[model samples]
Target: MKAYPITTRYIKRGEDFIPIIIDAIRNSGIKLEDGDFIVLSEKMVSTAEGNFVDESKFEPGILAYFCYYWSKYLWGYALGKLLNIKEEKIKNLRKLPKKETLRHKETVIRTVGLRYALKPYAEGGLDLTNVPGTYVSPLPKDPKKWAERLYNEVKKEFGVDVVVMVADTDATYRIFKWYITALPYAINGIISGIGVLGFLLGRLAEIFKVGGFAGCTPLAIAGNKVYKNYSIDQFVRIAFICDRVHNTIKNINEVLEKYNSYVITEEILEKLKHTPVVVVKIKEEYIPNR
Candidate 1:
């Protein structure tokens, strides 16, 4: 159950993740055991795959309208309420320049769409929270394949079986109700009637005094469980902190420091300074046994 942070070597635009993972494991001195697991943040994989999209590339169209109104009003509002997004920012969301506004708005839609259409298991907070610019990215296409590849690679290099898990920082909840409507892909993985159900259930969980982080902690655990045995060449989506799904992974630093007391060493910082990847150990509870 040891959670190891593998900071990748600053991966190039098209660099594959296999080698970066290998380097991280090697540098961290994490000798894998038969039951050991590797938890990978999907953002790292998305960056490796160049899954990002420039908001500037979007053209004014129906899709833009959907983002501007539907996402901003629905998903954004709900999350803003939960995360306490600044009122000023929420207000400003409505007055964005046509194109930038559309891109940001559409980013929400596309995020929601991916959640619903592609991975029903993904959660909300998939929108742009942390990145260098105005761009959004979705979960990788073949997590199972990527997981398999990483598993094989780690096994070959280290002579120990390691489960590969692709994770995001989004929070998730259980389905509280059923729906018969279609959601936009922009909001695909980020919002849905399913999420609405989860949201409601989250509220109920609170009222009932259930122990949870608004149902997100359990959902992240489920993502890890579901992908425990995915294809060797595929990436297995795994445990994530619901709060990490924001505009960037930068904020993760603070969360990591809060939950994990391991100091960021000078060597680690130096490596991270030059590489998109980093390597460190998180507390064991965050790691999955499978």
Candidate 2:
């Protein structure tokens, strides 16, 4: 399958993103075709919808401390290694300063739940990267509705039918025949709602020789596509491609280390190219029981 990345001006909170998407497609020089797949970044859409949350606005309490303990002790010293997490990350987790991350942990518990609090990052898909200070992007409200709107709008603009998928970098892992995602709200039959248990199981499955982890989480699919047209396995493959192409998107930590958190403004972020939209061509059809 061939994939094309569309670049547009950085989108800010509450900005109208649909027009930007359409404009990017128009300038991309890649014609949208029937049966193509259009993948969107959840971060971009959530930001456009003003779904970002400031952790500083929240208060950390006892339960948030427990989450801190989970990160510092369980994940840092024990579970992280078992999950084959990188040593540098484990070390950072062990050194998590309560002063810095406590409020964010509180926000995670309040927004998602205690179950999601067990996760180090991407708790219930309230991911904390690719944004300016103290902000997290939660799962977009009615993601499928958003996908349908974008699909209809794209079709209206281009006069071509296409599959529209909205996905996040938070992962969906596979073990044997079972598919489970780190975050809830994954669509097209990828199981979720188990909280971090899915991540634990999918990682541990490697030791048990059952299965291993796989692609990023796809939250919504529109145009009666994905599971209806393509096999779930094929769709998962498509999602991974989108995630890889999105590497052009920078992590906020890049600037946080060089400059003060308060000084790393949106203008500096605009210096980076964010590939929030990727269009894919399915070169081959999935054959049943092939």
Name the candidate that leads on lDDT: 2
Q: lDDT for every model?
A: 0.44, 0.79
Candidate 1 lDDT tens digits, 127-239: 24233355555665555566677778877888865445454444433233311112121112333344434444443444555522322221111122433553211221124
Q: Model 2 Cα displacement at 99 (Å)?
A: 1.9
RMSD to truth, every model? 9.3, 4.1
* CA displacement after TM-score superposition, residue 98 of candidate 2 (Å): 2.7
lDDT by residue for model 2 (1-290), tens: 87777888788888968889998999989888888889998988898788988888998999898889988899999988988887877877886767757887898888888888888766788856666667788988877877888899999999989999998887777788878887867885788888888878878887788876677788888873444866557777788878887844334344456564533457666887878999988864534455
Worst 10 residues of 1 by lDDT: 178-187
TM-score of each: 0.57, 0.90
